[model samples]
Target: MSQSLQAAAQRLERWIKEDAIPLWLERGIDTETGVNIERLDVTGAVDREADIRVRVQARQAFFFAQAYDRGWCPQGKDVAQKMLQFVQQHAAHPTAGGGYTHLMNPHYEVIDSKQDLYDHAFFLLANAWSYRAFGDAAALAEADRLIAHLDKKFGAANGGWLEGDYAYACRRQNPHMHLFEAFLALYDATGNAKYLARTAELFALFQTRFFDESNGLLFEFFNDDWTRLADARGSWVEPGHMMEWVWLLDWYSRRSGRPVQAYLDALYARGLAIGQAPSGLLYDVVAENGDVVDTGKRCWGITELIKASLVQIRSGHPQAEAIAIKAVDDLFTYYLSASTAGSYVDRRGADDEVIVDVAPASTLYHLIVVAVELLDHCEGRVQAR
Candidate 1:
């Protein structure tokens, strides 16, 4: 590694360990409910009135669990346990037979009781990490139960799980992508053949349904029968997701002994060609034809791009290290805050103005994962798959 990239990686490690994790652990939690607060204002004040999403809770749990595994935070395991308990107590539907509720008010009251596939994906992910962190068999058991519930309730006949009642109009590849991620985590945690099988199944679905072989892009929305949507509805694509799939496909290949170099090459090329704005930062959304849809940029997308770059570097892409370094620099320059040590501006408009002032708790997962990946690469822990 170059001296500059090494220094940047070290700086990100310090920021994540000393600033971000501590800030979130100190100020981002709701003491009354033992759940993470949804957001923190630029001044670092908790937004108590924000509606808590189940996905955020699960994300926080996953974050702390990973933190605990890395020895970054001493209380990470305890915090993960508290957050998981909160989910089990408050997020589960009272009368519904399966799946967790979608949203809750600040007071821990159920605001939306509908089951969402995205939310459940995170729930399973959290459990998988919790079990890995603390060796808690109950967490794995809960994950199994939730997986059973998902199969029973959200399973679609065509392939993949449905998006539930939330958006019955069209199916989404985003949720299935996440479920693919969760299944991978579960397989890692337990060496369960079933979870590995599910990962393979989701990968097949991605090849057939989500991935657009014509343009080398991944479509965001799909029809009920897993057909790509037409026109604007189907044309909308997120470069961040394409980048994310690059990372996931690489990981899947490493774990499953599957060869996905062709897929990675196509995704990386397409993401670089159509995913970036004029500024070189990854754009939020674009059409399949490469028209800019939403010029707004988000922190999560940038982090995913960094991850994809790192994966490419590990895979021996010639220019990938330079790309990864540039991504790290962009992340620090645009999204990360100067005054607020750990906080970030979540979104920026096309004009470079801040669209969202509050720092979302959900973004911690993205930041943490990027930092860890960079650190691993710099420290020679990442071996080429």
Candidate 2:
């Protein structure tokens, strides 16, 4: 491992162990309910009025479960269990499907009861992580039930799953990407061929629906018939999503022994060319033809870019370590909180100034993904596919 990367990894490890986890454990959780708060103020206080999205709860559960596995938090598993229990009590949908509702009030009353595809995918991922971390049998069973529900209700007439039960003019590839992620998580958690088979189905969807083979751009929105949704600005794409897909593609390659270097190279290269700013942060949105439609930078985008760089390093790309080191440095300098320790600035304006003051607990999921991966890479636990 490069010395710079090792140093960066060690620093990140300390930050997570000492600052981030402790901060969230104390402030991010609601004292009355034991569930994670949806947001935190600039001073690290919980925003108790904000409605809690079940997706955020799932993400926080994922973070805690992952922390337990990493030995970063000894009580992480219990915390995760509490969050899941809270989810089961309040977030359960009224439908027969195994999915949860989209939103709940601060006091755990139902706010938005729609059974959302995105939230379902995340809860599955959370359950997968919980099962992997603690061998929780119920988590595994719940994951299976969720998958069955998805197959029964979410199955679409075209290729992938429907956006949700709600009506929409266009379908989104974002949720499908996350479902692919959850499938991989399930496979890793249980050495099951069924999850692998499901992942392969999503890969096929990628080839025929989400991915544009001619130009290599991942379209975010698609018509009901699975055609690209476009406007005067052209088909909208996200560099962050490209980087995220690159990481997932690399992970799939590691597991399935498939060669995905071409896709990784194209998507990462194009993402950098179009979406990455001069300051090393990634833009929130961009056009297919390389125009920056939105110049704001989000914390999640930088985390995805960091994960992509680590996968590149594992692939033995010559400059990956250097790129990754710089990305880590840039992440701290530009996005993460300097004053607040665990909390982070969620987004930045076009001029690279911090625009968002509130720290949403949901972002901890993104940060933990990179943190654990970087720690593994630096410790030589990461193996090249």
Model 2, clash count? Answer: 0
Candidate 1 local Cα displacement, residue 315, angstroms: 2.3
Please give the range of 10 consecutive residues that has the lowest summed lDDT in model 1.
90-99
lDDT of 1 by residue, 347-379 (tens): 988976788878989999888888888888788
Summarize candidate 2's per-residue lDDT along 1-385 as a digit string, tens digits. 7788988888778878898999999988876787888988888788989998888889999999999998999989999999999888877887665788888888878888888888899999999999999999999999999888987988987878888888876788999999999999999999998998888888888878878878887788888788776664238888999999999988888888888898888887888888889888899998888888899999899889889998887777787788889988888887675478887888998989988979988888988888888988777786578
Summed backbone clashes in each candidate are: 0, 0
C-alpha lDDT (0 to 100) for residue 189 of candidate 2? 94
- Candidate 2 regions exceeding 4 Å error are 232-234
- The 10-residue segment of model 2 with minimum total lDDT is 225-234
Error of 2 at 274 (Å): 0.8
In model 1, the clashing pairs are none
TM-score of each prediction: 0.97, 0.97
